[model samples]
Target: MTESGTLYVVATPIGNLGDITQRAISTLQLVDAIAAEDTRHTVGLLRHLGISKPLLAVHEHNEQQSAQGLIKRLQAGESIALVTDAGTPAVSDPGALVVQGVRQAGLAVVPIPGVSAVITALSAAGIVQPGFYFEGFLPASGSQRRKRLEILKTLPTTLVFYEAPHRIVECVTDLAAVLGGHRQLTLARELTKTFETIHTCGLAEAVAWLQADPNQQRGEFVLLVHADVQEKAEGLDDETLRILQRLLQELPLKQAVALATDITGQKKNELYEAALAFKAANTHE
Candidate 1:
């Protein structure tokens, strides 16, 4: 009777091939078969590392069927390694179903952790705290994206998201609209690759900076928006107070306060009282 084999979930480098761990290399070399999101892409990496093994396609379209086959191979004492094009397998990628299926079949599933774009971005974000909520890849549509942003806006911990090149501009625009220009964000572009840029700036500045350079939108993006802040009574800066005052001119008091709250990420009651006070003081003047 053949002893059942282990299922190894390996992490590959996101960009620089050198980022791959030695254990990952050994696992790939020693495994009976390799299940990959894209066999062609993984082949290039294996060749670069001078390691060759059987490659199986297990992408989004056929992950379920592929997982079943991989499980059978495991049961038959063939050790398997699951890998994505980059980063950890099954992380905003594929392999979750396979991992679950393997464990359910009483097979061992081991992790080989390495570079993650989300963590890579957050580490340099200067976010002070260790807490974060990773919301990988926002919805494609404008309306759906905005709806998702609104729900995430009030979270107290830092928020992270992955975005593609084409949608980055609109994603940043929607972020500014829903979460306000006052909030700070860290934009990490083309991480670990040449021309990589990681910039921390206010939302408004980040938008303007990207708009100023077409090249800035060309690569992968990981956006890290700072957490919601609870400010003191007089925390509204002169610029914010000015915007609130301007909004009051064309909007109803309630509407103006709500807009101010969205724009500043400040408490609604605090903004309302301030708006009322500003209005009353102006009336006297």
Candidate 2:
């Protein structure tokens, strides 16, 4: 029987092929096989590096089943490398299951870290960085997304999120509306690659900036929103304000304020006044 081999969780460059670490390259070359989120993408990277090896498709959809097979290979002394199309694996990507399986099977799992969008954007964002929160990608649905943002609104740490091109504008719009227009934010698009753009501005101006240039809407994105600096209006967050405004559309002003107070724990009178302003401004819009 063959002895078990180590499973290496390798990090690839998010962009700029030259950014790939020497250790990652050497590990990939030495491994028996690579379990990739996308086999075709990994194939291209391997071709560029002039290193050919077996590729296994281990993406989100088939991860659980694929991990079992990968575990078997590892147990048979076939050292395997885990890679995603970009950046690190098992981080808003595939490979965690396989790593866990390998460990559970009494095989070693080693991390070969390099570039990550969360750290890449944070290093350049210029925001006060005692600490930060990585929320990854928010939920696609508006209400669900807002709820998640609500939970994040009160955190004192900077918030980081990964978003795709198609939904970026909408995501920024929701961020501006739910997080307060004046809150600071940084948008890092296509990091470490050609045409890379990183800009920090107020949430209010973010929508216009994104819309001003059509090209801004293209490519992968990492968004960093600054932490809440001070308590907002009537001690109510932008999320509670949003809910109060929505409630006003169907309920009486008093009733809306009551519900908002109950849901958000703000003073009812303050909520009533805020709800009135929200209704009047939205009406003008």
Candidate 3:
């Protein structure tokens, strides 16, 4: 009876080869076998590092068969490593099925975190929204993608999605319609590459910016949009802060807070505190 072996879930660089971590490099070199999403794509990475090993294709199409062979290799006392074409495997990539199979076969799955597009985009976006949701990439066709957006419409946090250049315009339009035109958005393209560009504006303005740039129609992009700003509030009060900001021009702090709270459904104490702070700051200036 052979005891099962360990499977390393290693994360590769999204674009830059320098992004590979020391641990990931060491693991890939030390593993008995590496199951790659694309052996041809991974060959370049291996050659760059001067490390050579057996490569197996384990993408969505062949994951089942690949997992069986990999499990047998593990049972034979071989350590295996999994690498996607880019970034971390199983993150909108193709290592999930193999990982799930490894677990079912009673093998250990250890993650080797390094570079990822999702993390890279989020960090450089300069968006300090309370939190954000990563919805990955939407479906390429049919009502499936629209259905996803309908659910995305209700989230109160920032929305982030990965998109291809060809579909970028359609994605922006759909997002604007579902999330509203006034929603603040940032479109980051070719991240970490030589021609990286970040465009920040409302939904409509983002679409316009894309149109203005004839060359921006190429490369991958990460789309981020504010989910909080809305014209009409469902349960919470609408325009409380804006009303308070407006009334401060005419009324005193106390009066403005009272009026704003009355007009909107916001809590009186919260509105009063915010109003007081706003008034104090303005008065000081």
Candidate 4:
């Protein structure tokens, strides 16, 4: 039996075609076939690179079905390169299922790292937070999105998210409401493109800024929210801190803070803030 061939998870340029890596180019040249999230889109990239190969559709709609066929090809000793419309594959994009299938089949899967919107934005975001949670794209529905943000609001680390141009205004508005208007938000749009823009301001002001200039809402977006900086429990008495911590272990943050507030006569908001700091410190440990 012939040995299975490798699958290359190639990372393509998010915007500037010039960002394409030389190694990625060489891999594309050598792969037996290229599996793309969007054939039409990948074809354009291939055309620009002056390389040609058999293109197969492996987009979000048909990823699972396509993955089976890809595995068959690998088993038949045919190498395949996986790519998305832009940026790294399988990262808030299609191609993850294909990679998972190939791995389950015991075929070699390699990464051809290149430009990523998240990293590209972070490189210029100037955020000093020690870590960040990449919450790619939020729910499209306003209610669902708000609930997600509420859950994430208390996280002490930076929160990163991607938003579409049309939903940018609404998304920011929700961020301001759920996460708080005072939080700093860095908006990175159209990275590596001619109309690229990176602006940072309070979440409350983001909607106004985007609305004032229609052009700002155009293109892709990467939003980085500053880390939550609530005060620790140092100001509270030892007994209050102890009660809050114990309650947190047994209840949801809201319920725990509420109960702690009632029991200790401490302010609810203060207890909530202290709870967040406690969770953040424990999360790392």
Candidate 2 C-alpha lDDT tens digits along 177-240: 8888746678999999998999876677798999999999999999998765434345777667
In model 1, which runs have C-alpha deviations exceeding 4 angstroms?
Answer: 1-4, 230-238, 241-285
Could you tell me how far off, in angstroms, the CA of residue 280 lies in candidate 4 after the best superposition? 17
Candidates sorted on lDDT, descending: 4, 1, 2, 3
TM-score of every candidate = 0.81, 0.80, 0.79, 0.81
TM-score of the candidate numbered 2?
0.80
lDDT of 3 by residue, 1-51 (tens): 111388899999877788899999999878888999999999999999999
Superposed Cα deviation of residue 95, candidate 3 (Å): 0.9
Question: On lDDT, who's better, 2 or 3?
Answer: 2
Shift of residue 81 alpha carbon in model 3, Å? 0.9
Clashes of 2: 0
Which scores better on TM-score, 2 or 3? Answer: 2
Collision pairs in model 3: none
RMSD to the true structure for each prediction, in A, is 8.8, 10.1, 6.5, 9.4
Candidate 4 lDDT: 0.86
Indicate the residue-level lDDT of 60 in model 1.
Answer: 93
Clashes in candidate 1: how many? 0
Residue 124 accuracy (lDDT) in model 3: 72
* Candidate 4 per-residue lDDT over residues 188-253, each given as its tens digit: 999999999988776777899999999999999999987754345546765686677667767888
Estimate, for each residue in 160-269, the C-alpha lDDT of model 1 and write its tens digit: 99999999989999998898775667899999999899887667667789989999988889999876442323677757765676687678889999898899888888
**Predicted structure with the largest lDDT when compared to the true one:** 4
